[model samples]
Target: MKSNLAYLHSYKQRLAFISVSVAIIALSIYFNFFQKTENPEFSKLTFSETKTEILPLNIAKFNPNTLSTEEWKALGFSEKQVATILKYKEIVGGAFTSKNQLKKCYAISEEKFSQLEAYILLTDEAGKKQNFKQNKWVKKELIISGKFNPDLYSEADWVKMGFSERQAAGILKYKNYLGGSFVSKEKFKECYMINEENYAKMSPFLLLPSKTPADFNPYKKNYAKEKRIIKYQNFDPNLLDFEAWKKLGFSDKQVQNILNYKERFLKGSFKTLDDVSRCYMISPEKFEEMKPFIKLNPDNFAVNNVVNSNVEMPKQKTDFAKIDLNKITFQQLKEFGFSDRAAASYLAFRKKLGGFSTKDQILKTYNIDKELTQKLIQMSTLSPLIAEK
Candidate 1:
C-alpha cells in the first residue's frame, strides 16, 4: 500500500511540472502573437509599430472557377458573385472562349473587367484567340492577267467586276487598305466582297488556294472589324454604276462621294454630305439631295465646329477645342498642363488604337482629367476627308 501511494505521489509531481511548463508555453505564444507575421509581403509591416494587413499576389494565380470565397474577395468578387461564376463555368464545361466573353457571365459585370483582371489567367484568352486567328481554311486566289498584270490586277477585270476605271485604279492602289498581300482567297474576298462573282471569275488564275496548318495572315488582324462596314465616306453625286447601290437607292454620284470621302478621310464618319460635297466642289442642292442617301457613322460622328468662335469676345474667350486630337503635337499638349510623357502616351494610344472613340475614352486614360478632355474636344473637332483625284 505504501509503495502504491509513493508511486502516485511521484506521478502527481510529474503532472504538476508539466502543468507549469504548459502554462509558460501558452503565455509565451500569447505575448508574441505579432511575431507570427512571416510572409514576404508582410516584411514591410515591421516598419510600422501598427501592423498592416498586406494582400499577396499569389505565386500561382487564382483560377476564378475554383476560387474560394476568400480568394474571390481578393479579386473583389463577392461570395454570391463567385458562386454564380462557378456555376456558369460549370455550365460551359470549363470552356471560356475568351476573357472578353467572360463579360457575358451574368455574375461578372462589365465593370469587373479591371477588378478581376489581375486574377484572370489570360493564357486561355490568348490561346483561344491565337487558335482562331491561325485557323486554316481552303481559299481561292484571283490573279488577274493582261494590262493590269504588272500589278497582276487588271482594269478590265475591275470594269467587268462593275468597278469603273478610276475605281479600278483606286482598288489597285488600295491594295494596302484591302489586305497588303493576299495569302488566301478568303482574305482577298473580304476586300472585294462588292464584286464576288467577278472575283470568282478571275479567281481561277488568281489560284484556288489552301492554308497549311501553320499559316496565318499576321497583318490581316491588325485592322478593326468596323472599318469595312460601308462603301465610302462620299457617294458619287450621279448614280451608282453597280446594282448594289441601285437596289439600295444610292446614286452613282453619291456613292462615288461616299467612297472618295471614306478613303480620303481615313476616319469613317461624315458629319454631313456637305463635308464630302464641299471637298468635291459639288453644289449645296446636290449635296442636300445626296444627304439622305449618305450614311453618317452611327457610333462615331464629328463636326469641326469646335473653333475659336470669339469673333467679338476676343478677350473673354476661354479655349475649349480639342487640340487637333489627331495631330495635337506633344509639345503643345504639355503647355496645356499635360505631362510630356502622358501626352505622348495619349498620342500613341490614339494612333495605334484606330482613332479617338470619344472624349470620354481619352478622359479615362491613366492620368488625364474629365474636365481637360472636355476642353480638348471643344478645341479640335474631326474633319471630313477630301479624296485626291
Candidate 2:
C-alpha cells in the first residue's frame, strides 16, 4: 500500500513538471511576440495591420526610373520614403537600371519589394529579351497608320504610334526639357531611345516640317533674272504704297498681299523693320537684301500724315542715360526707345542665355536691328559679376 502511494505521488510530480514546462513556453511566446517592448521604434501593429502597411493597395507596371515624387506617393510611399528612394536612384547614376537594384533601397522593405516585384519594369540582363519580345508584339499590334504631328502628340499619342509606354514617357520628358516641342524630325530622332529603325518607320508619317525655317535656303534653285533684280533704296516699309512696293521688284499680287498683311496684322502700319522682314511673301534672301535700306523711325509721322491719319505716332526720346544691361527692366528698355516687341525679345533671349556675357550677345537677339543693337551697346554696361563670369 505504501509503494502504491509513493507511485501515485511520483506520477503527480511528473504531471506538475510537464504542466510547468508548457506554461513556461506559453509565457515565453507571449513575451516575445504579444508583449510591448522597451523599444519605442518597434511597431505595435497586429499581424494583419502590419501586412496592410507593407503591401500597397494599388499595383501597376511602372518604371522606377521615371517615377516622380508624386507617383511614388501614389504607390503608397511616404514623402520621406520617396525622398530616400530618389536619393538612392541619384546615388546609383540617376536611375534604377534593374528591379534588383531598386529592391536594394532601404526605404523599401523586403515585404514591400516582394509585393512590388512583379509590377516593376526595368531592362536587365535576365529580362531584356522578354521585354524586347513584349515590345515587338506591342508594336506589331499598334501600327502607326496615318500621319501625325509630333509637336502636338502627348505621351499617350506616342504610345499609340508604336512606342512603348516607357519610351513614350522618356520622349515626352525629353520634349518638355526642350521647351515643350520637337522643332524638327531630326530633333525628334535625337531622342535617346529613338533608333534608326524606329525613326525610319516614323519619319514618313511625321507631319513636322522637313527643315527649320532657318535651315531653308531660298537661293538653292537658280532665280529668274527678273526675280533676282531687286532695287536697293532707303525707304520705310510702313510708308510704301502698292506702286512703291511694285517698284521694289515685287509682283502686283505680292505687293497687294504685303499691303493686306500690313493692314490686317499691323493695325495699318509696321511697328519695326523686323515686322516688314517677317512678311511671308518676302524670302530670307530678299529680306537680307532690303535689311540695310529698311528705315523705321517711330517718332517721325510725316509719312503717316500723308498716308493714313489714323496712325498713332510713338513718343520720341532722343536723350538717353547709360544703363546696366544686366539690371535693365522691360519698362526701362521701352523708355530707352526700344519697341515693345524688341524689348520682349531682348528679355526672352537674355533669360534663355541666363543673362548676356558680352555686348555682342545682344546682337544675337532676334528682331533686334543693328541700329538698336549699336545703341544698346553704347548705352549699356554689363554687371561686374556677369563680366567676370
Top TM-score prediction, candidate number:
2
| Candidate 2 residue-wise lDDT, 259-329, digit = tens | 65565445557778777776656867678878889887675334432335433333333223446786677
Give per-residue CA lDDT, model 1, range 63-143, as digits (tens).
344455676666666788878876786686653434665767888765566556655543334333223346553222222
How many clashes would you count in candidate 1?
39
Which residue ranges in model 2 land beyond 4 Å of their true spot? 1-61, 65-104, 109-236, 240-275, 278-311, 317-327, 334-357, 360-389
Q: Estimate each model's TM-score.
A: 0.19, 0.29
Show pairs that collide, candidate 2. none
Q: Count of backbone clashes for each model? A: 39, 0
After TM-score superposition, the amount by which residue 40's alpha carbon in candidate 2 deviates from its true location, in angstroms, is 25
Candidate lDDT scores, in order, read: 0.50, 0.67
Residue 218 local lDDT, model 1: 41
How does residue 276 of candidate 1 score in lDDT? Answer: 60
- Model 2 residue 263 distance off true place after TM-score fit, in angstroms: 18
Q: How close is candidate 1 to the true structure, as a TM-score?
A: 0.19
